[model samples]
Target: MGDPVTDPAPDGIDEGRRLIRLGGDKGLSLADRLAERFHRLTWRTPLHTLRLKGRYPLKLIAVPEDPILGDIARGTMLLEGVLSFRGEARDIETLDLSKPHPKPFAEYLQSFAWLRDLSTVATRARGAPIAEYLMGLWLTAHADTQGGIAWRPDMWGRRILAWTAHAPLILSSSDQIYRSKVLNALAKGALHLDRTADKAPAGAPRIAAWCGVVAAGLLIPGGEPRQAFGEAGLLRALGTGLFDDGGSVSRSPAMLLDSIQLLTLLQESYAARSAELPETVAVTLTRMVAALLGVAHADRGLSSWQGGGPASETQVAAVIEASGVRTRPLRQARDWGYQRLAAGTAVLIVDAAPPPIARL
Candidate 1:
């Protein structure tokens, strides 16, 4: 079989049309709008109050993973509750955990989601307890509110994955009470992901949300229903996010890498349960690997396309290695609209056609 027909029309046209129609008289009535407004107002008022007061969940669920690149473990040594990133340290308790954090620090905090890095260093012994402490701090300082960056769907998805992946490190404490709190919090996080995943913005964010839910479902006991829901959402996301040619809908090399990684995680999650890999997942993985190889340059790196930077050859090779799909690069990608030119050991890749109008 050949590649499926590429839709020349811009993406989201159908959705846009539906939204337009909904904006007409067929939309919600005035009373319904007023009720919605009232409900939103009530919801927001409390949330805003909570944000200002910084009231949060007192119980911690799982520890976030530390970044591979920061000196937080060393920095946290300086002050009892201080987390340092990029030469600046702030006491976790004093910072306004409810509002948006300042730049570099925010990025640092996000990286802190991968707390395993701290365990690899001299702070190995302190890693678990510190992780629990920081988590408790965040829970007490931020988790109760609903409108901050910490509560965003994507953030929640990330937190779930990070917590699940590093559960051992976070849950290592002898404190049974704290352990129970962490588990309960994880359950709540999974539930939140399930409820809010649909509202996550399209593409990678939605995929991440679904994948997190899938991971939670597979790892958490008695979670078959959540697992099924997650699998369904993930499959839907895969259908839209990937093209028949195995390329990403966004047509960006970077996104292709992300899709590959997402698939790998999903595959591993299923494998961990000794479950058969879903047929759709298996097939998609195969095609996506082929697509990645097809676009790869002779040097094993990708061409700069679709607002993506030139990827390092090492990075490309590593991604291929991680894919676990052994296949040669495709010589041509007609459906994806790319041409590969070769002369002896020299090679050049060119975009054969203009980007889809809709993407612009």
Candidate 2:
């Protein structure tokens, strides 16, 4: 067969081109590259080697290949550099062509080796379940500015739900091991805090709160309650953590957008299971939507102001719909996610109406 039909439709196509122009050419390319590069780097391993240096003249010793040992050595390096960017000056909004340093790009920088290896693994699997599983792992394991537990682990948790949520699309019989690893990592990250030492930021309680969102999903699938406590605790924090005016404690537009997304995801996940959200959480989410909507620009995206991270139209919509808030659009933040619709821009026209779709 020829190449798969991965191209997006007309509305999505225009939105993408518009995205490139608004976001920047370099960032878009980097996101695509980040996706491809990760799939490549993780497919294989080299023979194990042992180095010995002492007063005696000794050379390196060849040893039997051990996947587990190699994994530990490489994993430690991966975790360190990846984790370091957590407290750094990075955020997720600029992970594309616009900002000098996007969080996704940082993922590319910190774990290029792992990403490269992952890319290879994906190619070999080629349209297989392993590819999706690995891709989600690459995206989730990536360290955004939130550091150890935020986006990286958050993505891990989300992707697990995504897999479970859209099981047929991502998981199948051919990729059982891939599924196992993804699920296991998500479970471990959700339930086991001792696994990583990254702590919540001083300003935002949502970091810990978002962990609860992830833990909720992880607990559901694993049939365990250990993860649920943190999930509930995080929700409690998110309910109180979000400011009275619906803004993030950080007050960065980028963070505001991200927090909106985190809350929406949590709410939707619970809603999917017919769970009742705490009234405070619901109120906070609604307030946040109003606050973010107040600040959005004409283009339906944020103004890239105040050292904002990357905020896109899609993310904005997802949050808005998830928040169950009433909204109106401002032309300035057209690309801010939900603001486009709020502004009366027919997303189906811009996102769904396009033909002969574009591919990154």
Candidate 3:
């Protein structure tokens, strides 16, 4: 009813408009800056682009002409509002490190853990940053609460907590205090899984696999701690759970690419710290990449597989670059998951599968 706050904030508005324009240039045809802000805040990347390498038909999931951009913008706004000032909010009170948290607070902390994963991909969303702060707050507040953050019953919540296991190992290395909290939370989470295995859903194996991954990641940082149990479980789960013949356990093409992206991050994290990734881990990863190349459409971008994926070839290129391994180019003659490189084009995706699986 009143003038929109976005009508002011010259820098924010201009930046928002520029981001919207960039999306438009890529063919999203956003109607206005407000719409663009919505897309930036929520979708993170264009949904149309996310459809790359996906198998699900986009038309079925399309919202009414209104689009999802509005939700993104609102989320972004919340982030800016919260972060406008530094340390204005009071420090969270210390909690008893030895006890379990109350149910509601524990649930919120679990959600906060999940938000960190969501925020990683939602970089452009205003909600992205807000989600980050909420996650940090939840962790800070609940670390000492009764039950340190544990797995929630919901699938999405479990996925979020599972993913957060990597961040502390990778990003919190310098912050021993934070890192220690992460270790405690991870152990608590694993313990909860162990206690409730019988009550877990049929798909709980996936979550178990991730718990192993988190353990593996943590071990890498703690001076390659000789935790035989955790390390063995991680290797087993990654080998068995993360991949399928087509590439990823989750058939969502977007998810497959995301897995690759995460692997690249993990690989780089280890390399940056001068730690060695296990040989079995490296071999499995290479096999995964080869399988991905097998399915990649001719343009060097993955064809839409099941759900959604990145449209840009840039993502795949980044993965390849990070891998530090030379990928064999797709052959023009075969035409199955093959990319043909002519004089001008650096890469092109064609549906040509690679010749037979080679032993790693």
Candidate 4:
């Protein structure tokens, strides 16, 4: 951990290259294939469909914190039938909702990440109907179980979180039939998450799917097994995707922020039940907070690294506050490959290794 300027030439270059080759050609393993077959068989059953159409969780374990100003502004625009997502916006009426959407936006729409913003509008009397109308349109267009972007694991994961956190907003409609439909859809989505959490591609998507599963388990009544499954999957994902030193496997700052938020939500969910937080969850959160603090610049913002965008100081601070952890910045990281140097009034930071292979 000496000064980076005087460090020896790094080792493991060839090992890295060899590892990359091994990873590049790797296909689904036998276990994965078997799991996929099980999923296909289980997901197609009429009993599963009937289960989805039944009663939903009567109460949510947690409601997401209130929307910020940005959410309100965007939500207002959405009420006007204008769709803005992934830095692109178009009139909802102008696009063909029946067919596939353009790149990024299609992914965005399918993910329903924008539902958070829409929930802000739904809090208002005038905006609630608009939110309901849009939800109805999307459901009619993309509720197919077999094939559709909406049914993708990652997309469904995000959608489940959105629908759960904003249940009050989505269920505000006067039409009891539509309310039933929304509840049924949410149940279906949760079931889908439970079935596919393990099959989800590694990293954030996998983590998200498990989180959704955990949320469903906690909120849905008579779902002890589902809740246990969700908790176990979430813990497993967290263990694998997060390093012992608290950095994410992907080495992305945005991912760190997202992880913090996810953990916060889970913590709140446990709190809602007056249950003890898992030791694994508590320990990982503490480590993640310290790692996040290590990467913060003097301006209190995270430096751009690992292809992550510049995160605002406010955003980072909010995440840390949400974690409820009090920790100091890491002065030296052995496994994480970062160094901090200070001399009188001057301070410097250095990246001590190549980007993660996944980033490459």
Candidate 5:
């Protein structure tokens, strides 16, 4: 991998990370950052926290399957008390939530997306017990607490979807009290998402935050209001995050893939409840999948662009399979700015769009 710094220009998101670490980020003024940090400070008050603690639905109205598959081998390692993400692993046999970790690893843990992967291999080993223990620790530590990485909207959203998607795996136990606690935690998470999904960092993070809101609304009883709010936010995000041709505003293949997978999970969640898919969500999925195929090589993998690597064929196939979008490969994607041309046995994929922007 070439350093985005020296091998090529760094991506805007990477640059943003650099600026944030230096406290020189231009996206948010100090006041803006502080305001974002405290938009719903009332949620964190001890009285409000106690009110949430007092009651919760004892069970989800339904359980939804996450179409994305988890790595069996990674799930096995997770059962062994370790989790690895972006080349960083933590021995979480017993992790302290207050302790700091590298950013990517921290987000990975807080997202609880691992629960999906672990669900796949959990029945074979002690996956259920391990999941319950770790989740209990998280609940104990962060109950109704706000701020920090754990409460970041994207991670919060992912965690809600994860908890809801694999409720059987994560909430499985004979202990009624523990079961109630997990259910209450899910309600609390959904409430937080309801109030703060828009506060997530823009682009994919914003999309992710909204995904959680929709998923919770769909699976939890009497969540019609959240579902409606989330769908509206998602529609607004689409106008900015996607071109008419459905390429990501970031112009990264990786981001496109992530968007497909995230939305697909939410789509399937809607399906599980036998509900009508929202028309805009349906339309966006179709266009994004077609745009993804346009960028794929004849062999079914994507070209690297905007600091994204050429994604693996297996990963791409899984996303498409899960998406269930049958739109043909895009030949000429306008505004998305890619053109696929072939003659004889030769193939050409052109980068027809403007250079990728860092902070779309």
Candidate 6:
């Protein structure tokens, strides 16, 4: 997907390319890698680890509902040890946390977000043990390694959301020690997210990180302070990471989908608590749904625009349904970055904005 300039018109896409040249929505640079290495080393110090030892919400105030629906077939596949996330599929047997992997798949594995999918299985009794087993494996591998990928701010955030929303599945084991490990892991993750969420890269990753923080705050007993802290960060992220028009800063349809999905998971926490939805969150969802619909074709599949591919209708519909926001597709975008036109069976979508800046 080149920069979205026009819908196959004679007009060239130099404007989008010019924007890309200004920064890096294209790929991470050497500076990004070096700074991350230094930061990782610095953050992994003994003192840092000690600070991370703060209160682990040892028990849940309540189990959250998993709003994003999972496919029964996919859930069964996850039981068979094949994991899928955001269209990325890889064998669980082949997963290696110590080695490099695709960003999407690694996020899926490290975060254990697949629990959302596995929960869709008709027989919870059949899948609970496997979920427990996976949790055990995660603990054994990354429990003590705070510097590892599993402890990445966004990964921790994602894990917190998963473990909390689908708590019943992972917490199904009656083994006291196993239960302790699970709770301890959740505590560690929430604490880690608290410390590092602000440092998460802007856009979908930051949203995921903050969503985890909020999830922990809501479900963890005595987590009011953390909840407050997380909501502040989330609001800040939304302010910067999205255009007022509800489009993602990244201008990628995929990013919009991810933001919706992450926020929907957070809404589950809100619902479980019977808490009022934050006004900002409510508004953001409304705007985002409108913007997302701008790129959605008549078939309800997302049209590829600005370095993204057309997402399957099933996936798009699932995210929209899970969002529970009824909004019409936007006809025009404001930093949300697209223009839509429709006439009977004809529809044309144009990318009217530059790519997202690197810092975003």
Q: Number of clashing residue pairs in every model?
A: 8, 58, 40, 0, 1, 0
Residue-level lDDT tens digits of model 4 in 17-74: 3212213324567787787777756656775566556466544555554232235666
lDDT of 5: 0.75
Ranking by lDDT: 6, 5, 4, 1, 2, 3
lDDT of 3 by residue, 119-219 (tens): 44344333333443444554565533322234332322243233343243223234556445544554444343332322222122433434334333333
Better of 2 and 5 by lDDT: 5
Q: Model 5, 220-277: lDDT tens per residue?
A: 8888887888899888777667776677877777888888888888887888899756
Candidate 4 RMSD computed on C-alpha atoms after optimal superposition onto the true structure: 6.5
lDDT of 1 by residue, 121-228 (tens): 435466677777777766776555455556555566666666765666677888877777767666666776776665555556677778878877777776689789
Local accuracy by lDDT, each model: 0.61, 0.40, 0.39, 0.68, 0.75, 0.78
Cα lDDT tens digits for candidate 6, 201-239 = 888889999999998889988889989999999998887
What CA root-mean-square deviation does each model show from the true structure?
8.7, 18.4, 20.7, 6.5, 8.5, 6.5
Between candidates 1 and 6, the TM-score winner = 6
Q: Which candidate achieves the best lDDT against the true structure?
A: 6
TM-scores of all predicted structures: 0.68, 0.47, 0.44, 0.79, 0.84, 0.86
Per TM-score, the best of the predicted structures is 6
Q: How far is candidate 6 from the true structure (C-alpha RMSD, Å)?
A: 6.5
Worst ten-residue run, lDDT, model 4?
Answer: 3-12
Clashing pairs in 6: none
Question: Model 3: residues >4 Å from true position, as ranges?
Answer: 1-132, 140-183, 190-227, 242-246, 249-251, 329-360
Instruction: Count backbone clashes in candidate 5.
Output: 1
